[model samples]
Target: MRLSLAIAMAEEKVKEGGKNKMSDKKWFNKGAKAGKVEKREKLLKTYEKAIEVISKYAVTLFIKGFELSELGRHKKALKIYKKIIKLFPQLNVAWFYKGFELSKLGRHKKALKAYEKAIEIDPQYAEAWSNKGVALSELGRHKDALKAHKKAIEIDPKNALAYTNLGELFFKLGNLKKASENVEKALKIESDLVPALNLQGRIKIEEKAYDAASESFKQAMSLDGANPVHFLWDTYTNYLKIGFNLDSEDKKYQEEIATIIRNLEKMNETLSKNQKQEKEMRAYVLYFLGHFYLKSNDILTAKEKLEECIKLKSKSSIKASARELLGNIWNYRIKPPWWRWWLNSPLYRWPKRFGFSILLLLISALLLLHPFIPGWFPLLQINWSLYAFLIVLLIIILFLPNIKRIQIKGIEVELQSPPPYEPVLSPTVMEEIMKEIEAKYTKLE
Candidate 1:
């Protein structure tokens, strides 16, 4: 009986042990699931904080890049901006700024690509579209430039820069009337806009509205105090090309000349004060001064300045101009070849010039005299009509566009095409932006 009882008790103890093992397994699975849930919540919070930190860091980097760009350190700005773009490919503003810096460096083709990428990211970006137009214009693709400007205007009618770019394109196309109208629209939208003001001045000069053009230039200078050197250089080049008739002694003409000289003197003073002015810049000022004095009929001063320009020899075009002018001063005058002058002259009212009428008369006279002079009048039957034609051609050549006197005015000034303007974002604007960024960062903290 005792042996049977021991066996039964052992079986009951085994069943209780099996039940305890199953209960412990269930408790272990429940605790493991709860621990996993806690870990997932903590990881999610960490990612959120990381994203916030990254965003703040991006804003700070952008400000640094902007400050570098403002300081004319374009390559450094590009490095910072490229880093931002690599980390945040979706940031359209970063692409726009990259394009702007590229444009500043005169890498218009690369700038265009950057702008296109920005546009792809955000088609509604008006500044990007407008800047794309500028890039196209720089590439000499006027038709495409017009299309881009129109697109910007379509996206945002109030985009002043779009209108300014439109004006510039039309000016290039020689549609001065349309250029003026578009420039007017830009100025109306934003009167203090420097580019619009400068462009308006260009249009006014083309229209022969000298006073209006002068006012526009003065306004641009006032608005662009940060770069006085540019103002002086631009103003001098524009008026010099306007073909001012100094011999007329017109009051407006005198005042304009006086203003140019005064500005040149002021430029010298400014340069003397700022030793940072490069040797090339000083050479350019001398070249401009030479031309200014030449136009003012101060031949002695002009000769001195031009000689200095040749000595420096910084810019090839300026050096060439100085040499040519010096030769003219020495030789009384040195004219361009007749054929070149004719080709360079404006086609407007060309028929009214003496060359055209004289050619017509000589042709008529040759035809009338053709029969009177025999075909075989002289040796070996040289056609007399051919001789008459030759004589007429010789006479026509004599009257061809200032062949006798070297007129180095008007279309004769073959200056190099104007350098592209620098990027126009002001320090004040950047400072405001930095302030906004700091405010946002503090609020987030």
Candidate 2:
């Protein structure tokens, strides 16, 4: 009986051992599954962080490219934008900016392709559509350009740039009424839009509203204080056109011509170094100056300016115009006598500082000689002794330097006998003056 009991106990122990082993295998499988779940969660978190980092990097690169483009470094900007597109093919803004740079570089076909790619990525991109219209217009695909601009306006109802672009297109198509309407709509939406204002000025010029066009250009210049070259050129050309349209003997015609010449001289003084370096701008200015002088009957000055314009490597059209004007001067226009040329030269022209004094002196001399000359008109009688005192005072005024004080943007500037040929304050001088004023104020504060 004892042997049988001992065998039973051993069998029970073996069964318990098997049960424990099965439990151990189940725990091992559960632990392995939990470890795999944890590892997958870690990998997923890492991937999300990597994607976020890449997105931020792309945004940073895009901003850099945009800044470069704003600084007029389009080629460098294009490379940066291209790099971004290569790294992040899905970035739509990169493609859009790539198109902008390409358009600036005059590669309209490639710009169209880039813009199309952007539109494909984001169909709602209104800017892309509008700029694509610009490319199309430049390519002479006017119908397609119109469609693109309309689509942009449809996508974003208040897109002022798109409206302005549409206005420009209509102007090209000779639909002045439609062009004016769209430009007005654009101005209504964004009153300070410089391009819209410029377009408005151009339309006004076409409509023969000279005063209103002047106002529009002035507004544009005020709004675009940093770069008003386009507005200046437009205004100058419009004034020239007005002067040409009027009768040469009309008082208004002479006034208009004088205004243009004065403004051109002022522009020459204020031109930045960069602007002075622009051969095209210089050529245009010279051509217009020559044209103005020719109209004013100053043949010698006109010839000089036209000759200078022809010497510059400029646009074919401008050079051709200069050549034609020179031909007309040589072939058709009568040359003025040497004495008239001397009188019309810069030295004998009315001096800015002593012009009024000189006029007064001439009147006084006429009064002093009244007794010796035959009186053509008895109504011109005056007190001789009083006129002699006036003559002395006028002589003093003419010989003495004039002191003038002017306030510009809350800064007081003093002048003594300002130069007759140049503006008293040029752009470079104004900048320096502003800086000095700011520095002084900072010190005082």
Candidate 3:
């Protein structure tokens, strides 16, 4: 504080000593540099002096606001931007940045208004249009987002962000072919674009091309350094799904699992940086952690993480997924451990058959003892009646489709055969679900 005051006094002394041009320019540069370098205390001091020195300089104010937004001090940046907009109502850039800051704060409707104002001021502003599309997308106005992105592209044919946004818009709309085309165009223009790469990876995953999807995610990770843990979570979860084969003993599979766990540990460190205030983020991270642990056969850890996820944010899709996974965990662990322990035993493969035979024998013994019951003769008779019943049962078991069986640890566990149920939600469907959730939350807010 004393140093800043001393610097401010020295700067003022230089300004008053007949060095008007040099001092004014130097002070403005110093203030701008302070903002850029995130010297917040110094910047605030310089901000007060800058108003007195270059009171008419709108560019300096915009630079300050931009720097604040970059530093994630979005509400403060919004205040600066609002002041800029009030003073220079015709400045499209001010409105554009106000919208940018508002969008950063998740005020999509206000962002849309600010973006619309910027567009109204300058129809050819491709960046504003692209950002408007993002705001529209966040607001669940898919059609408007499409139009805004298209308008951005029309205004500037080579705008890579416009192309990427268009690709994401198409992805949300479930037109994977068009999504792929636009993302490819974006990559052609800017190959290292993280969002485009992530979107491309998502599209690959939807097509069940897990290897290709993983490669794309790897490329994205290379481009996007490891600071923000959210992207890491996405990459880790993709790897988990691809490498998750509960019964696999393959060397390659084991290596992939090891890599995923290592990545997850690093992500855990990243999450710790802001975990306290990020309840939803905690839920997301824990959900994936639970999923990875489950796939890695760490049932206890999986159950713990998933239950933590539910307790943190009980309303999200992450919570729903966590609950589903927890139910699966309980169902799996409740079964006799011996069933899994004897995975290498010869009878393990046909344990269900042996168990079924034992059950039938018990029934036959009961029927023989209770011959007075109706149909006891046919039920107890094994010469032809029982043989016919066994034949019919074998045919039905062999030919007729029943519940899907997942062979886990040598046990053919029968999965619930949902009656011709709709397929699992794809990324597009998940987008709609998220939109619904956000809308509900917005209404509550």
Best by lDDT: 2
Scanning candidate 3 in windows of ten residues, the lowest lDDT window is: 436-445
lDDT, model 2:
0.67
lDDT of 3 at 224: 64
Better of 1 and 2 by TM-score: 2
How many clashes in each structure?
0, 0, 0
Between the candidate structures 2 and 3, which one is better when assessed by lDDT?
Answer: 2
**Each prediction's TM-score versus the true structure:** 0.59, 0.60, 0.57
After TM-score superposition, what is the CA distance of residue 238 in candidate 3 from its true location, in Å?
4.5
- lDDT measured at residue 27 in model 1 versus the true structure, 0 to 100: 35
lDDT of 3 by residue, 173-209 (tens): 8999999999999999889877777778778877777
Which rank order by TM-score, best down to worst? 2, 1, 3
Query: How well does candidate 2 match the true structure in TM-score terms?
Result: 0.60
Off by over 4 Å in 1: 1-45, 233-259, 277-281, 295-316, 323-445
On TM-score, the leading prediction is 2
Task: Tell how far residue 194 is off in model 2, in angstroms.
Answer: 1.1
Q: Where in model 2 is the C-alpha error above 4 Å? A: 1-64, 67-73, 233-246, 275-277, 327-445
List, residue by residue over 332-434, the lDDT tens digit for candidate 2: 4543343332234232235442565555658677667767654765776667688678776565444333324556699986643333232122334323433
